[model samples]
Target: MNEIPLEHVHVAPDDGVEDDPAPAVFVLHGRGADEEDLLPVAAELPDDHHVISLRAPDRLQDGYTWYELDLSAGGLESSQPDADDFRRSLDLIVGSVEAAVDAHGLDADRIGLLGFSQGAITSLSLLLEDPDRYAWVVALHGYLAESHADLDPDGIGGKPVFVGAGAGDRVIPQSRTEAAIDHLEALDADVTSGSFPGGHGIGPQELDAVVEFVASRTA
Candidate 1:
C-alpha cells in the first residue's frame, strides 16, 4: 500500500458546552466505506463530543481499505498488512487524536474509539495497544485480529469496552467474535459484549446501545 496521508472529517460540539478542551470520539468505517460513510452515525452521538471519521489510506474501487484483503484458498478474506504498516497506522491515528485535541482544545482523558467491521479492527488494535490513551471503545460487528493477541493482557487494566455482533454475520463468523470477547475478558477488561438478532449490519437497537455507551463514556 502506498503511503498517502490519512484524511477525515469532524463534527464539533452542538450542545454549546464550552470547555478549554472538549472530549472526542474517532469513528472508523467498514471495508468499502469512506470516511463520510459513518458521519451520520457520528452525528447521533452526544452533542458535546468532537466526532471525527477517518478515511483509510488505500483506495479500493469506489471506497477505501486499511489493508490488502487475502482471499486465496482462504475460508475468509483477511488483512495482509505487515507489522510495520499496522504500527505506522497506529502512530498516524494517535497523532491525529493528539492533533485534534490540540487544535480543538479537546479533553484528552475523555477520548473514545468506535468502529464497525473493518473500522472496528483498527479501533480494537489501538484500544488494546494502549488503553491508557483512550477512555472507551465500542467495536461493532468486528473481532480482534490474532496478530495483536500477544499484547500484555494486563495492560487492559479493566478499561471499559463494548463489543457487539450480529447473530447472522457469516462473514465474521461466531467463532471470531467469541474469541475476541474471550480474549478481552481473559485480560480482565471492563467489557460489555452481546449479539443482536441481525446480520452484518447495525440496527436501531445497536444504535441505542451505542448512544448509551457514548453517553456514559463521555459523561
Candidate 2:
C-alpha cells in the first residue's frame, strides 16, 4: 500500500537502537500544533522506547491539523475535510509502523499510540479501523467519530485505552466524551480515564496518569 507522505519527528534511545527492538509510541499533537509541540510529553515516556511525533498532513495557520471542524451547528461537527484527513492520517500511522517494524524490528505487541485533541481523535479512529494493530491508545480531549459505530468490534477486546478529559471543558461536549467512553467499553476495551481541572489542556496530574498507563502497557 502507498502510505501517506506525512512529515514526522522521531526520538530514539542512544543505545541498543540497532541491536534490540524496543517499544514504540507514536505521539500526536493537537490542532494548530506541530510535531515538535508534543515532544516534551513524549520525553516523559520511557527512554528505552522509540518516540515518534508526527506533523499533520495539512497546514492550519502557522501550525497544523489532522482534520478540520465545523461548529456552525452550535457544537463541533465533523467536516468533510476531517474525515478525508483522517484517511490520510491513518495511512501515515500504518506506514510508520511498518517502517519501524522493518527498520528497528520493533515488536508489534508493544506498539502504541498517544494523541491530544485532533490527534487523539485520529489515534482512536485508527484503532477502531484496525483494532488488532495497536497494543494500546491514549486519547486526550477527543471524541469518537460517527462512523466508528459502524466498524467491526471484535478485535478490540482487552485493548488498553487511557482517556484524559478536562472536567470544565466547554470546547468538547460532555456527551461526546461519554459516548467515546461508552463506545470503547462496548467494544470491550479496558478503558482507563479521569477528568482534570482544566479545559482542553493537559496538566501535570493528567500527564502523571498517562505516564502510569503507558508504563503499565509498555512494561
Candidate 3:
C-alpha cells in the first residue's frame, strides 16, 4: 500500500469483507468545505462500499479549496480556474486515488467519484484526462473547465456520468452546467443530468437521484 497524497476520512463498509476487495467511492467537497462536509452523505449509500472523503490541499478561509478562481476576466459566474493550480490539484487527486486504492484494499475497477462545486470540476477534468481510470462519476454544481475543452479521449464512450446542477445557481450559472452536459453527450458518455430549484447547493431530490445513480452502477 502507498501513502495517500491528500488528507482524508475513511469509512469502512457496514458489512465487513473477509476476502473480496470492496468497491470504493471518493468524495470531494466544494470550496471552503472540509472532508467531513459530505461525510454524512456516505451513510445514505450502500453499506458494502468503502467511502473515502478527501480534503483539498489548498486552505481557504475556514476550509479548503481545490484550486483558486481567476475572476480577472469576469464576475464569479464567468470566472475560470487558475491554470497552474487546477493542473496541480488534478495531479494530486489522481495520485491520491491511486494510493488510496492500494491502502484501503479497494476494487480498483469499481472506483467511483462524487464531487461538488470546484471538486466537481476536478472530477470531470480527471475523467476527461483518463477516462478508463474511473468506473463512474458524479459532478454536482460545476461546469466543464475550458482548459480541457480540446481533449477528445478515446475511452470516454458510454462511460457513466451524473451531472447535477442548480437552476438558480448564481455562482456557476445553469448554462455552464448545460454546456458540460452537451460536451459529455457529444463524447458519447452515458450522461444522466438533473436541475434543481436551489442555488449552488444540492437539494433532497438531487441527493436522491445521486444515490440512485450510484447504487445502480455499484450494485
Candidate 4:
C-alpha cells in the first residue's frame, strides 16, 4: 500500500555526524493537537539524534486526530478505538516512518517513538506490530488499543519502553496504564513506568523523566 504523506517538522541534530546516518525519534501529539505541539519536548531530547514531529491525518476540532474513539462503552476510560480507522492510521504511520528514514538518511535501527494520549496508543501499537522496527518507546497518558491484544510479536523482549500516566487521569485511568505495563513486563520488555499526581496530561516531573529516559536510551 502507498504511504499517505504526513505533514511534519524535522529538527536536525545539533551535532550530527556528516557521514553517519543519525538516529531518530518520531514524536506524535495527542488528539486535537498538531505537529508543532510537542516541539518543545523534542527540544529537550539529546541533540545528537534527529527529531520528527508528525501531524495526524484526520483533522479534529481545530487540530487533528490519529483515529476516532468509540465512547459508547461508557466514557473516555472505557472507550475503544474505531478498529478500521486505527488500522489505517497504523499503516500510514509505518509508511511515513519508512519514508522519513529514506528521505533524511536516518539510522532506521536506532529509531525511537514518543507519543501522548491517542498518539501514545499508536506508538505502543507500532511497537507491538513490529518490535524490531523501533529501538525504544515512550507512551504517556494513553492505554493499549484493544485491537492489538491478540498480537504476539517476537523480538519484543528486552526492548526499552517507558509508560507514564497521571494518577488522576479520568480520560485514561491509572488502571489502564498499569495493565499496559503488566503486558509489556509479561513479554519481557525492559519497562520503566511512573505516575504523576495530576490528570490527563504530562507534569513537570513526568517530562523530566521522559527526557531522562529518552536521553539514556539514545545516548
Candidate 5:
C-alpha cells in the first residue's frame, strides 16, 4: 500500500525521540485547507508523539475537498467518489500511519487521529468503516457521514471519541452533529461531545476541551 503523503511539521521533546515506539497522531485538514493548515495544531499536543497532516486527494478551485460535493440541490449534497479512488485514499492513510509507527518503533496501539471540519468527517468515516485502527479520534466541527449508519462498532470496540461543535456552525448544522453523536453512541463508542460559544470555528474553551480529551486517552 502507498503511504499517505503528508505535508508535515514535527515537534520533539527536550529529551528527543526515544528508541521505543512513539505514539503518533494523523491530523486531517478541512476542505480548502492543505496539509499545512492543521499541522500547527500538533504544537498543542504532546511532544513525544510523531504528527502527520495530510492533503486531500483533489484540489478545489481555491483550496481542496476530500471528495466532490454536489450542490445542485442548492445546498451541499454528499456523493460517493468512485469506489477505487475512495478506497485507495483510505489505504494510503492507513499505510502512512502504519509506516510512521514502525519507523518510530512505536507501539501500534497508541496511534490516534485529529481532524477539523471536512477532515473530521473523513476521520470519522475511516474509523467507522475500518474499525480498531485508532486509539482515539478527535473530531472537531465535523459530522458522521450518512453512510456511517451501516457500521457496526462491535468490530472496533470502545475506542474513545471526542467531538467539538459550535451552536452556530453554518457549515455543519448542530442538528446533524447531534444525529452523528446518537449514531456513534448507539454503536457503543466511548464518545464525548462539547458545544462552545462560536460559529464554524474553534475557540479557546473548545481547544482546551480537545487537549484534555487527547491527553486523557493517550496518557
Candidate 6:
C-alpha cells in the first residue's frame, strides 16, 4: 500500500493559561494517541511555560502514530529508512514553532521539546538533527531505532537533555533505554537518565522528575 502523507497541528493548553512571550515547550504524544491525549501532562507542569502539543498525522485505527510499526515480540518498527520524510516533518514542525514564537514575542532560544513513545523518538531526533532549535529535550519511555544512530546531532548545542524510562517496561527494555543514553552522552550532550518502577507508561514519579528537569533548565 502507498504511504499516506503526514500532517501535524498544535494543541494549546487547557485551564486557560494565557500564552506569554516567556518560552514554549512542544509536546509530542505516543503511538495511538492524539495531540490532546497528553495535554494533561503538559497542564500538570509546574512551570508557566507555553505548552504546544502536535499531532503525528498518521492515523492508526482511532488513534495516531508518527511512523509505521512492526508489532512483533519486541516493540520495534520496520525500518523504512525514510530520512527525507523525517526531515520534512521536522521542518514543518519547526516552521510552525517559529511562527508561534514570533506571534507571542517569545525568546526563540528558550524553546524546548518533550515527547512520549513515538513522539519521544521524533523529539530526540529533532534535537539530534538541530541541536540549537531547542533549549532542552525531554524523552519519556521511547526507544531509538538503528537508523537514528547514523545521524550526528551536534550534541544538543550545549543544552540539557533528560531521558526517563520504566525499568519494568513491557515494550521497551532497560538495555535499549540505557543504550540511547550512552549514544547521547557519546555525542557530548548534557544528559540525565532516570528509571521508574512501572511498565511502558508514565507514572507520577516520572512526571515529577520531568517537571523538575524542565523547570530547572527554564529557570
lDDT of each: 0.79, 0.79, 0.91, 0.90, 0.74, 0.74
Off by over 4 Å in 3: 17-19
lDDT of 2 at 165: 83
- lDDT (10s digit) by residue, model 5, range 83-130: 454566666677777766655555687778998887788788889977
Q: Mark the regions of model 4 whose C-alpha exceeds 4 Å error after superposition.
A: 1-4, 15-19
Clashes of 5: 4
Rank the candidate models, highest TM-score first. Answer: 3, 4, 1, 2, 5, 6
Please tell me which model should have the higher lDDT, number 2 or number 5: 2
Q: What's the lDDT of the predicted structure labeled candidate 6?
A: 0.74
What is the lDDT for 112 in model 2? 87
Give candidate 1 regions above 4 Å deviation. 1-5, 71-73, 77-85, 153-155
Q: Candidate 3's residue-wise lDDT over 150-201, tens digit each? A: 7889899999999999989998899999999999999999999999889988
Q: Model 6, 1-219: lDDT tens per residue?
A: 222233344444345556555677888888789888887888766455777777776678889767765445443523332455556666666776776776556678788888987778778877877888888999998766565777775545456999998989876677777878888887778888899989988899999998888878876
lDDT of candidate 4 over 59-99, digit per residue (tens): 99999999898888887779888988888888888888999
Please give the range of 10 consecutive residues that has the lowest summed lDDT in model 6. 1-10
Give the number of the best model, judged by TM-score: 3
* TM-score, cand. 5 vs. native: 0.87
lDDT (C-alpha) at residue 110 in model 1: 86
Mind giving the per-residue lDDT tens digits that candidate 1 earns over 15-113?
A: 667855788888888888899988877788888888888888778899987765545536563533445656766777887777777776778898899
- Alpha carbon lDDT at 11, candidate 6: 41
Q: Is candidate 4 or candidate 6 better by TM-score?
A: 4
Q: For residues 1-219, what per-residue lDDT tens digits would candidate 2 score against the true structure? A: 434246788787667444366778888898899999988888887777788787887798999988777544454533323556667777877887777666656677778899998888888888888878888999998888765656756688889999878888777755577778888888788999888888888899999999999988876
Candidate 5 at 20: error in angstroms? 1.4
Better of 1 and 6 by lDDT: 1
